[model samples]
Target: MAITPNYYETLYITRPDIQEEDLAKIQQKLQDSISSNEGEIIKADKWAERNLAYEIQDHKKGTYYILVFKALPNASKEVEKHLQFYRTDILRFITLKTTEEAVNKNKASEEKKEKTEPTTPTPPPAAPPTTTAAPTPPPAAPEPPTAAPEPPPAAPEPPTAAPEPAATPPTEAPASTEEAKTENTDTQEEGGTN
Candidate 1:
């Protein structure tokens, strides 16, 4: 036979009326037995009294207890044997490998996260953005109008000279004798005015 290295947990139910004092005594005895057998009692959790699925020994409700312990493989058989001998209990049990220290199980590991002050002091709240500096949010951006407005480039140069400044001066004058004479004179002198 070879010894093994691992742990197992067991849960069983006992009659509900078996008062807390007796329950504690029974648990202590079991703990002692396990230690005496060269095993360590990792943890024991007692659940609130509750009803069972079926009556075992005519008791409708029972106490649910979970025991986590580490020991050789034979330790499981020892626990089962003790549970069977104690007929006062409904005596249902299970055993499995433990993944962590039972004491920390289900307990929040982050208790305020070991709070530390920030390396840099907190900055003051920001004031409402000023209209002059902070650009306006441009109203919910209308559905990108079918036509987008484009701004001309910032750089400006001298306006180019007109190509045909005199191309349409004839028709601009009213058709009157005085106007006719003025137009002929204006064209003959190349835009010389009286």
Candidate 2:
């Protein structure tokens, strides 16, 4: 039986508040630890600052880094322990065992892209030649007639309904004086009969 090392990819994030010098020191520490543990690093990159999907350890943003390496299982554990216990600048981290083929594939693609891209920066476009003659001022565009702005047409009024007939309260007719006298006399005659 032969012991074999495994490939791993570790993605870690550091607190955004740290200075660039401090960040460099952290990366150096990780590299040193990996080497000390007999781990061979294949790739290491700082991914720059990014906003976190959610805050971790009171940090809403963090600088990300990725490390890919081949190491014995125990060696990987040691690296993780170093980060988990010693690196307070780090906000979060995850390590995943990956295939060597995947790592090689990614490396190959990156190399191909670099080779295909242009290396030299194109020169800035030459400035237009300056003329010594006084440039004729472009004829002032005829000032459009300055007619006073017509006021916006008043909005059409909503159609009004026909005025409804006024409601009249029923009124009682007043009794004539002659009619009142006759009614009183009839009441008196009835009283006399009773």
Top candidate by TM-score: 2
Report the number of backbone clashes for model 2. 0
Deviation in Å, model 2, residue 100 alpha carbon: 1.0
Expressed as tens digits, the lDDT of each residue in 72-154 for candidate 2 is 77767876876786467888889999998999999999898878665533322322233323254444443332221121111
Candidate 1 lDDT over 1-194, as tens digits, reads: 66664677788888877767876767777777677667898668785588878887788888888888877666777777777777676446666666555435533342333332352234322344464446656665754542222211111111232323323333322233234444455565675452
Candidate whose lDDT is highest: 2
Per-candidate Cα lDDT values, in order, are 0.61, 0.67
> What is the lDDT for 110 in model 1?
26
- Global CA lDDT of candidate 2, please? 0.67
